[model samples]
Target: MTVAPGPADHAELQRQLPGLGQAPGPVDAAVPAAHALLVHPRARQAIVLGGLNIGYELVRVRRRSIGMVVTAEGLSVRAPRWVGLGDIEAALQAKARWLLGKLGEQGERQRRLAAGRIDWVDGACLPYLGETLVLRLDPQQRGLALREAAAGDTPPGRRLLLGLPPQADAVQVRDAVQSWLMKEARRVFLERLAHYAPTLGVQVRRLALSSAQTRWGSASADGSIRLNWRLIHFSLATLDYVVVHELAHLRHMDHSPRFWDVVRDVLPDFDQARAALRDPVLPAFD
Candidate 1:
C-alpha cells in the first residue's frame, strides 16, 4: 500500500493480494452451517457462516460501514458505534465467502513465511538484490562487507562477511546484517531518486527507509517519500516501480488515471515489474 503521510483525509492505496475473490453475496440462511472453527485471541462475538463457526474481535468505531480485516491472527470486525450486533453479523454473513477465503490465504502465507525464515548463522542464506547471499562470519573484519563467491566456500555463492565471531548469537548476526541492509537501502534509494526525479519533473524533499509490514512505499503532498527497506531484496526493476509510483504522487496525490500516466511515462514496463514484485517469497527476517 502507498500512504500519504498526513491527516486522515489524505489518500492511500490498499494493498490487495491476488486470488482473494470478490465481495461475498448476501447472507443465506438456507446454507448449512459447517462445524469449522476460527478464533481470534480477543474475540467477543461469534458467527456461523458457510457452516463454519468464526470468532472475531469486534471494534466499535466512528466509521460508517462495517469493515473486516484478516491478518495472521484472524478476523477483526470494525463497525459504526451505532450499528447493532445483529447488523454486524449480517455484514459478516454477507461477506462470509470472502472472509473465509482471506483467512485461509493468510494462514497459508504465514506458514510459507515461517518455513522460509532465515537462520542467522554462518552459511545461512538470504536474498540480496534478487540474488542469494550466504553469511560468512569474519571476526577480524570491521563491519559487514560483500565479497565475490570464492571456490571451496560451502555454498559457493556470494558471501556477506559479518564482523562477528563464530560464537556470535543469532540476534547479533541478524541485527548486524539488518543494519547493513538499511544503510545500503538508503544509498540505493537515493541514487534511484536522483535518476527518476528529473524524468518525472519532481523534487523529492526527503526519503526515509520504512519497516512497514503492509506498505511498500508512501508519498506525501510535501514530496516526502518513505519506502520499505525490504524492497532491496527484489530486483532493481521492481524497486524502481515503487520509486516512480511514489514520486508520481508528488505530482498527483491520488491514484487517478493522470497519476498512473505519470508513472507509465517513466516506466513503460512497470506492470511487469509490479507483478514480479508479488511473486517472490521474501526471506523472513524474524
Candidate 2:
C-alpha cells in the first residue's frame, strides 16, 4: 500500500495564510500559466494558481478556519460557513505552492501504483518475501504447494503450484491466491512473533490478520496484535521491523525515545528495513 501524505498540516496552513479575514480581491493575473489542470469529481469551485487550473470540492463546515487537503484525485477545501467563496479562493492562492507540490507527488504515486497492478492468470508473477513468485495452474496439485525448479527454469524464483486447472478464471485464481497467502501469512507471523517476543520479554496473547486500508500493523494494550497480511509480500527484514516496532510498544505505549531504544536493542539496523517497507510499488491484490 502506497501511503500518500494525509492532509495539509494545520500549522503550515496557518503560516501560509497569516490573515484569513482579509477582504476578497480579484485573482492575480500576473502569475504565468503552467498549462496544468486538476479536477475533482465533486468540485463546486475552480481557481487558476501558478497557471494550473484546479477544480476543488468546497465543503462548508462550522469551523473557525479553512482546511485544505490534496489527495490522489484532486483538492478539497473545508471552510467556515461564514467564509465566502472569494475568501476561500484567496486562501488557496496563499497556499498554492505547497498544494501543487503535494498534488504532483500524490498523482505520480497513484500512477506508479496503477502501473504495478497485478494480473491474475496462469504464469502471472507477484512479489513474495522480496522475491518474485510465479503462479502455475496445475489441477493435479493438491491445494497450493511451493515447488522449486531443478536448476534452470524459464521463469525462476519458485512456483506456487495451485490446484486450479489451466482453464480457471481470473476470479478463481485471485481468490485461491488470496486464501493461500492469508494462511501462509498467519503461519509466518506466528513464527516471527515468537522469534522476537522472548527477546523483547513480551507475551503476545493473540494475533490476527488485519485488512485495514490505512494501517500496516497495530498493537493492543491487551496483548493482542493485528498485522496486515499484505505485508507477506515484502521481505522478512521489512516484516521484522513492523513486528519489533509493535512489540516495543508493550514496554512503552508511546513512541518515545525509550521505545525506539527497545526496538534498536533487537534489530540494530531496523531503520534500513523500515525504509524498505515504505517502497510504494507493492503488488496490488485488488
What lDDT, from 0 to 1, does candidate 1 have?
A: 0.79
What shift in Å separates residue 148 of candidate 2 from its native position after superposition?
3.4
- Assess the local accuracy of residue 53 in candidate 1 as a C-alpha lDDT between 0 and 100: 74
Candidate 2 has an lDDT of: 0.81
Scanning candidate 1 in windows of ten residues, the lowest lDDT window is: 10-19
lDDT of 2 at 134: 90
Over the stretch 20-42, how does candidate 1's per-residue lDDT look in tens digits? 22344555655433223347899
Q: Alpha-carbon error at 118 in model 1, in Å? A: 1.8
RMSD list, candidates in order = 10.9, 8.1
Residue lDDT tens for model 2, 3-38: 222245344445657755465444455543323345
**Candidate 2: worst-modelled 10 consecutive residues by lDDT:** 1-10
